[model samples]
Structure formats: structure tokens, C-alpha cells
Target: MNLSRPLDSAGGTDDSLGGSLAFGVVKSERQRVGVLAVLIVLLIAALLWSVFGPVVMQPELREKVRASLPFGIGMLTVMFLYECTSFGWLTQLIRKGYEPVYWVRVVNAVIEPLFFTAVLAFLIVFVGPLNGMAGPAPYIYFPYLALSALSLSLRLSLVSGITAAIGFNVAAFFAVHGLEATPSTAVLVSFPHYGMKGILIVLTGLAAGYVGHRLRKQLGESLKVARERDRAVSIFGQHVSPSVADRLLHQSVELTGEERQVCVMFVDIRDFSNLAAAKLPGEIVEYLNQLFGPMIQVVNDHGGIVNKFLGDGFMAVFGAPSEDLKLARNAVACAREILSSTDRLVAAGEIPPTRLGIGLHVGVAITGNVGSEQRKEYTVIGDTVNVAARIEQATKQFRAQLLVSDAVAEQCGPDVAGAVDLGLVELKGQPKPVHLYQLV
Candidate 1:
């Protein structure tokens, strides 16, 4: 019922479905209003013609004019009706990601017009003869029949002017020859001639529809591709860190928190300051994205929540109000995963090979909204977070790629075997010197 990004694991929900439907309804109504406006214009022209034209005119000319008006109006009406059908079907097809311009639509267009034209032809032929036989010799029943056929065909074709002219003349010729039953001085009408003309028009429509359908199909494919490309570029530009923009994009997830023990990881790229100082702002952002993409992927795969993204790094918190208790293990796994994935990225010439330092700590922390009421962030704040950052910083002194505090090492348990003593180190903002270990 819902629509979502193809990359997202969770399929869309009812809300997305509702949103799509609302947009579709609005668009359909707008089109309908436009069609109504056009019909109104036709009405105004019809009214003006009725008022200006004389009631009594030349017999031949009067017949021609009367026939012509209905022919044009009937065709226009049929065209409007079919357009509504085609437009509605096409909208649904495009929205659902299907190519609607297939052989089927062509077939429908042909069949629809033919069916409508045949109905008009039958009414004209059957009705015209009865009216003519009972009426005066100057009765314009034949012209009326010709006009009805012309209008039905012309409207169906959507090219009324020249086509209607040719058709009217042709129908008049056939009527004169086929209805020889009446005296030379009397007017006559032939149902058989109208029937034959209907068959011809239907056949012509089939051919035209087939060709038009193919052209529409090709044009639709190119148009779809171009629009998709534009959409992709727009999505990419709109992409933001899930931590910041997830609330806006996904309305389903409740953006709230409860106090709980959580594993926190603070990671920073080595020599990040020097790199930023050398590169331009745009280059720096691009470079950071290249380095951060894989690292972020590792965290997300391990079921960790990215809390905040720093300029040259990101802060990840595992096991919070919305996380599993085994968040410490997940964090350690993520760090190892990031280290492994970076090797491939370096070889691809995307990002330079650089060492990443991560500090992991697990303990009771006031993990919730922090900062002033005007602007707040969901983060972990306590000795546990501070200790994690200190241990990671210890990596520089020990000449190690990864470093863990005594608390994190304890949580890691017997699974973590290789460890080197970094001795006691004065942690900033803390009174006591904390013991650190290097993962050898």
C-alpha cells in the first residue's frame, strides 16, 4: 500500500499509500477541470453561430450547414470522452512504473473509435431513410446522414477539418448513386451506403492507431528515462544523515528516547585536521563522504544507530531505548568491519588509505536529549563516553590502529585476547588517570 526508496529494507506503509493516492486525485481533478473549460468554449461558439446564422437560407447550403454543425460537435464530444479514458489509464500506468504505451493501447484507441463510429453510422442510415420517405423532397435527411457520419469519423480521428470535408463529399457521392429507388426529382437516403462507409473508417482507424501507438511507446520510454534521471539526482541531493533527517522522511518511526545503558563509539580519522587545512571546503566534504560511506554502512549493518556526524568523523551509539542489550559486541564488530572495508576503498582511488581510531565504552549513561531547549541532540553523556574518547586518543601514543579502555576490554570479555598495556593516562575533564589498552 505504501511506496519507499528501493534501497530501504523496510517496505513502505499505509501513510505512503495515502500520500500517493492524494496526489493522484488532485492531478486527475485538475485535468477534468481543463477538459470542462474546453467544452465551455465550444458551447459559447455554438451559441454565437445559432444567433448570427439566418433561419431561412438556400436549400443546398442550408442542408450542408446543418449537417456540418452536428458532424463537428459529435466528433468533438467523442474525442473528449475517449481522452478522459486514455488520460486516466495512462496516469495510473506511469505512477505504477509500467510502460503503458504498448500495443494494447493502440488497439483500444482503434477499437473505441470504430465502435463509436459504427453506432453513429447505424443511427444515421436507419433513421434518415424513414424520415426522408415521409417528408418533403427538399428534406435534408441525406445531408444530415452524411454529416453524422462525417462528425463521428472526424471526431474519432481528432483531425476534423480536412478529413470531414473529404468524407462528406464521398458520402454524398455514394448516397446519390446507391439510392436510385427514389425518382430523379425526389431526395432519397441509403442505410447500406452508411454501413459501408462505417466499415471503411473503422479499418482506417485501426491502421492509424497501430502507428500512433508505436510512436507513443518509443517516446514514453525516452521520457521515463529522462524523468527518472532527474529524480535520482534530486534524491541524492536530498540525502542527509539518517540521524538528522530520518524524522522528516519517515513519519512512522517515533523520534523519542528513554534512559538506558548504551555502547557508544566515537571515531575520528587520523590527521583529519591537516587534510581539511589542505583541501577546499567542497573537496573536503566529498573526501569525507568517500571515507565515511563505508564506515557508516558497517555501523548500520551491525544494528547501531548513528547519533551524530562530526566534520571528519561520526558518533555512533549502540544499545539505547530503541536498541538491543548486546550493543558493546556490535560496536566492536563495526570497528573491525570498517577497518577491513577501507582497504578496498583505498585501492579504488576513492579515498586515501588512512587509519581510523575508535573508542568503545559500555556503561550506564544519561542517553537522551542533551543541549539547550532551543536546540537539542540525542546523545550519550557521562564518564563512559568520555573514557571511550580518551582510549581512542590513546591509539596515537601507542602506535596502534585501535584502542579500548579497561571498561570496554572487560565488556569485550575472553573473546578479546590480544591487548597491550598503555599504562595510566590523564583523561581530560576527569580527576583520575585511566588505564588504557592497545588491541595488538
Candidate 2:
């Protein structure tokens, strides 16, 4: 089925295709966001380790490492918990809402300083292997730094702010100790400062675990969103078509500026004027609405867009909005369905035997959105539209219910065996004559 035609032309809705596409986009974006975050963090961590070396222990090295580890560990833990909470929050928000602003984020921000100070301060007081701390000064530095990190994290998303704070703290620590600079030519390397060394090792391992946890949490959340989007789109696609609903959900519009071959079909009820004259206006409208239901089903079943209802007639198109090789086949199928349904209606005495004329033609057309900013419709506009209409008019002269241009017949291949040739005729207002075929 080909569905890339104008919706208003036939007066129908397309939700199936649109919905599927929408869900796909949402899923992809969510996954990409998670993957990108992980990659960026990995890069920053690699750079930090490279510039600062594996471990620092002496008094000089201890001070430098203390400053840097907080930022790294602080960021890692904050982002980890944020992602875990964010997933739950987002899912709840979408389904209903169970209060996203909880204590998790607040606690995450507060914990960085508490954890850093506890570990570093305890090491300074008990072990005293590195340079001796000046009373609470060393301990105060850790909390002060942690609070600063927490404050920075509040402005950005928990993940982004944490990462930035970590990066900033690390750079400042390394800069203050001249770790980023070349080794001092005059001073020789000192012995390992056991307390500083133990603290540094502990912080790095914890930070790594924290970062890994965040990565896992983010990936899990992304996967959930993808699955949900897919499930929703699938269910929604069943109601309308996937195509239209997907577009609406994802908020995407295709504007491909390329001319392409298309199959156009136009149908009109015979003696519509007489029917309207005999019946009340409301009755006529009600009857037309009922008729439109079946017609729309037929058209959409064959992957066509119901463009518009012009008075007593309706227009449909295939191979545009998007294109496919089965455009003409779909149109032909639609015509057959219409004929069969109308015949049943006539036999049941619901209305007079419908004298329908379906025009089919294949040609190049400018297929896209048409109309001004306030009122735009997706449709094709070109000579092909005119030719299809004329072929419709020719159905009367040919004594056939369906008239197709030679262009359409060629595309139909063996299925066109039952069609009869209609000699080339000069259509009204046409510069060139067109060859037509009648489907018996």
C-alpha cells in the first residue's frame, strides 16, 4: 500500500504509519542521549587520570589529590542517583504523576560533602601518615569544597551539574598543586604518604563504581522509554494508520522537494444533484456521510490518502506523501472495493445503484503541502491531477465505470489484460492529446 498522498483530498485520517514513526524517533533519541552521556564522562575521566597520574601520596601530592577526588566522586555519585531517580520520575510523570520532587536529589547533593569530609577528615585525624593537618582546617576544606560542588550541581541537571563541578574541582586541585606543570627540577620524589595514599585509592574506586552505576541507570531508563514508546505507537497505530499518528506524536513534517510518479484516483457519485434536489438537505448530508464511511475504508485499505470531498466527488492519491511501487495497484484495489461495496448497497435497496466513475492516472507531480500558513493541506498539484479528472469524465463516453490513462495501464502490467483500448482523444483545454484505456 502507498500512503504518501494528501489526506484532505479524500477526507480520511491516517494514524497507523504516523504513530509508528513517532515512537521510533522517541526511542532513538532517548538511547542516543544515554550513550552520549556515558561517552562524554568516560572521556573526561580518562583525561583527568592521564594528567594527574595514577595516585598521589606525599604531603604535596595529598593536598592536590584531596581537592580533585571530591569533584570526581561528588559528580559520580550525584549523577548516579539522579539517573536512577530520573527514570522513575519520568515514567511516573508520563503514566500519571507520583511527585518527582522528592528527597533523593536533595540528599544526593548533601551526601557528596558529607562522604568526602568523613573519609578525608577521619584519615587526617587517625593515621596522620601524610603532612599533619592544622586542627580542623583540613577537615573544613573537604566540607567547604563539597558544599561548593553541591551548589554548582543545583543550576544544571543533576548529571550535568555534577559532571561540571567534578571537572572544575579536579582542575583547581591539580592547578593549585602544580600537578599539571612539569615535575620540579630541584626537588626529588619523596616517600609514599600512607594516609594520603590510602584515601586516594579508596576515593578512586568509589568514584568509578558511582560512575558505572550512573551509566547503567541511564541505559536502563532509556530502554524503558523506548519500549513504552513502541508499545504505545503500536496500539495507537491500530486505531488509525501508523504513519499519521507517528508524525503527530513525534511532531515531524516531511518536505521532500522532489517530483515523483504518482497514481491519482477521483470518484464521484452519479446523479448526486438529483439526489440532493429530491431529499432534504440534512438527509442528503447524512446519506453522504454514511457513503463516505465505506469509501474511506476502501481508499485507506489500499494505502491511499482521502484528499478532499468536492461537492459529490472525492479525490485520493498514492505514491506521494511518500512513494512506493504499488501505488497504481493500490488505486486499482480501491476502485474494485468501491465497486463491490456499492453493488451490495444497491442490491439491498439502500440507495439507487451507484454509477461511479473512477479515474486513474500515473504521472509526475509536485507532491507536498499546499495552501497558506494558516490553512495548509498535503496534496499534489500538477498536470497529472487534471489528466486524472479528464480520464474520470471520459468514463461516460467509454461506457465503463473506470477509465485509466495509458500511463497507469502500463504500470498495472498483466492485471490490465481485461482493459480495452480507447483511441487517443484531444481533451478540452489540453495542448496534447492523451491515450486512455477502459477497465471492463
lDDT of 1 by residue, 217-313 (tens): 5544654565565555446323433443443233223444456777888888888888788889999889888888778778878878677677777
Clashes of 2: 29
- Cα-based lDDT for every prediction: 0.55, 0.57
Q: What is the Cα-based lDDT of residue 152 in candidate 1?
A: 21
Q: How accurate is candidate 1 locally (lDDT)?
A: 0.55
lDDT of 2 by residue, 301-409 (tens): 7887777678888888887666678898788878878888888887888766568888898889886655555544556789999988888877777668888888888
Q: What stretches of model 1 exceed 4 Å from their correct place?
A: 1-257, 370-376, 421-424
